[model samples]
Target: MYTYIARQAIFDRNKHVHAYELLFRDGESNCYPAHITPDEATSRLLTNSHLSQGLEDITQGKPAFINFFQDTLLHRFPTFLAPEKIVVELLEDLDVNEQLLDACKQIKQNGYRLALDDYDFDLKWQVILPYVDIIKINVSMFSQQEITERTPALKNMPIKLVAEKVETYEQFQFCLELGYDYFQGYFFTYPEVIRNKSLPSSKLNLLELINVSSAKELDFNYLNSIFERDVTLTYRLLRFINDPLLNKSNQITSLKHALTFMGELEIKKFIALLALANLSDNKPGELLKLCLIRAKFCELVSAAKREYNNPPMGFLAGLLSMLDSLLDQPMSVLVNKLPISDELKMALSGEPGNLFNYLQLVRALERAQWQLVTDYAKLLQLDELLVFQLHHQALLWGNHIHLASQSK
Candidate 1:
C-alpha cells in the first residue's frame, strides 16, 4: 500500500526548474498498464498522493503537471488539485471533438491552465490550440525535418513549446536553437563529475551524529556535548521529539532527558532520516521516501517475528542499504564508516544472516513479487496476509514521519 509516484522535472530554457510531471506507478511496474482505465488509474493515484503519501511532501511546493483523459476532463475529476499549483495535461491519444472542446473551454473558464502533451502540429489538433497554454513536443518521435517544418507554424502560436525526451546535450542545444521555451529529460542528471568529490562538511557532521546516536547504549553526557556544539542539530532534535504525535506528557527540557525517555532507537532513526534529507537537498525527495519505507518495513518485520533483540539493527541496515546510491560511493566503504555491528554490516552487504533475510523480503515486497514474498513469509513462519498488512502499515508510518519532518 505504498503509493509510488514517479516525477520528472520540467526545466525552462535557462535550466531552472519550472514544474514537475507526476507519473503514476503501482509499485509493480514502471509503465501504467493498458488494462487499467485512465480514470481508475488517476483516481487511485490522487487518493494515494492526497491522503496517504502527501502531495506537498512529494512535489516540495512546485507546481505539478498531471495527465487527464477526455472523460476525466469532461467530468471535472481534478477538482481536488488547486488551480494555481496544477496544470492539466491533455494526453496525446485524446480525440479532438466538439465535446472535448467544450470541456477544455470550461476548464479554462474555471481558472485551470491546460497543456497538450506529446503534441504534433497536425490540423486535427488546431481546434484545441486556443485553449492550450503550453505544448509539449516529443523530440524522440519527430525527425529534424518534421520538427523544422512544424516550428514555423508553432512559432506563430501564442502557446509556449516544451521539448520532451531530450536525452543529450546535443538534442538540448538543437531544441534551444529551435526556440523551445522549456526542456525535460535525462540530460541534467549526468553532469560531469569532479575528481575525488567528497561529502560536504555539513553532511559529514550529520553522518557522525547519526553514527553516535545509533549506538545501542548512548552516553548522555557525550551526546549532550555533541549536541551543544551544534545549535541547529540540538534544536532539530528537540523540536522532533516534542512533536504532538510522539505524545510526550511533559515538555522535554534537555537532550539527556529526551534521550532517556525516547530511547536510543527512536532517536537514531530520526537523526538518520534527518541527515539523509539534508544531504539529499539536490536529489529527488522520493529517494529519501524509499529509504524510510525500507527501514520501517524491516523494523516492523523484525518486531513481528520477535527476533533480532535489537530492532534498530534491522532498521539501520535497511536505511544504510541506499547510502551507496545517495553518497555516490561504494556500499562497503560507507558501511565501514558507520559505528554499527558487524552483523548489521554483513546483512547490509547481502551476506546471509537474520537482518539480511528481512532486507531481501522487503525488496521482494517492493517489486510486488508475490511468489518470493510468499516463500519468504513461509520460511519466516509468518502468515502472508499478516506480512502484507505489516508492509501497508509501515508505508503509512513512514509517510507520516516524512510529512512531519517536511513541516519542520
Candidate 2:
C-alpha cells in the first residue's frame, strides 16, 4: 500500500545485470524492486520510489517477504549469480576516470556484473575499456557511415557486445552479422503477434453458458456445460471469483457456486477481464501500466457511482473499454463474443453511460489535459477544487504502486 522504487541497472561489457533477488520469491516475477540494504548502496544516488523504500526498508525494518535487490543477490546468489543480478551494459560516451574505476570496483566487489549501456567508443572514453565485461550498442542510433566506422573496431573484443533496439527481423540479422549478443526490446513481441483466429467452439460454449448464468433464473446445467467445455478457463474464473481485491467475502468452492450470487454477466466480464490482463503480458510495459490504470479507475468509479444502485456492469464496461489495446485488435472484433448488456456496450463505445463518462474523465486526467478533465468534472458535478484533489490522490496511488513494485 505504501510506495517504493526499483532501479534499472546500467551496464558495460565487463559488467551485466543479473536477476533481481527479493526476500520472498515473488509469485509471478523476480524482475521487481529486488529487496536491498540501503547501507550497501550508501554511496549511490537515488530518486523517485527507490530512494524512499531503500532508506525506509533499511532503517525501519523488513518483513519476511521483503528484501533489497542488492541484499538478495549478495546473500542468495553469490558466485555466478552476480551476472544475473546486475545489468552489464556497454555505456556510450562515458570516459574512463576514478569515478569509473571506483564504481566498477565497487560493483564487482558487490558480486554484481557490470555492462556498458548504449555504448559508443571514443578515443577519450578508453577508461571503460578494461572494466567493461558486456557492451550494449544501440544500432538504431548509427548511420551507415557510423556503423562502418564503429563496427570494425569492436569486432574481436573479448567482452560480449550486445546490440539493442533491433526493431525488425532484418535489423536483428544485421546486428547478428555485426556480433550482438542477447537482445532486449520489443522485437520479440512483434514476432509473437497473435493473428486472426476464431475462438474455439469450447470457448464459445463456455461464453454461452456464462450468458445463461446471468438470467433472472439460474441455470445449473448451462453453468456445468461451461466447465465441460474449458476446465482451465474455469480455474482462472474461480480465482477471479475469490480474489480479495475483488471484494469477495468468502472463498469460492466452485465456479457454479460463484454464479449462485455474482450472476452470469458479472462472471463473464470478470473472466474476460482476466483474459485481457493475461493477453497484455507480451505488450509494452506502458500498455500493462495503462491496463492497471484502467482497471483501478473502473473499480473505484464503479464503487462510487453504484452507491445509489448496484451496477457491477460499470466495472465491466470500464475494464472492457481497453480490450482493443490489450489484444492489439479492434474492440469490435471480439466484443460480440460476450453477452454484455446494451447499456454496457454503449458505455464502452463512448455513446454515453455512467461508466463511459468516468472513463473519459480518467483518460483526460491521465494526460493532464486540464480543459477536458475540468469539463468532465463539471459534468460529473464534482467540485472543481475537489477534482484536483481526487486527481492528486489518484497520482499518489499510482506513485505508491510505482514505488511498491520497486520494493519487490
**Highest lDDT among the candidates is held by which one?**
1
- lDDT for each residue of candidate 2 in 1-408, tens digit (9 for 90 to 100): 122222121122222322221211111122132453442332122222243344323212211111223332233322322233234332343345575566566656665556666775656546656665666677788875687668777767777666666565466566666656555433432333345755555445544653553244445676566566666666766665665645448788886677667766566545545454445444444344444445555555555544322336545555566655555445565556656677767776677766678788777655445567658777877654554444434444433332322221
On TM-score, the leading prediction is 1
* Candidate models: Cα lDDT each: 0.74, 0.49
Model 1 pairs in collision: none
Over 1-408, each residue of candidate 1 has an lDDT whose tens digit, in order, gives 334444667888777668878766553433354679767767766776553335665556667888988788878876667787888999999988999999999888888889999986678988889999999999999998899888878888898898999876678889999999988876553322323568777778778776775787666666666667678777766777777887448687777777678876777677777777666566545556667778888888888887655437767777776776666666677788888889988987778987888888877776555567767887888876677667766766666666666654
Per-candidate TM-scores read 0.66, 0.51
lDDT of 1 at 197: 63
Model 1 RMSD in Å is: 6.0
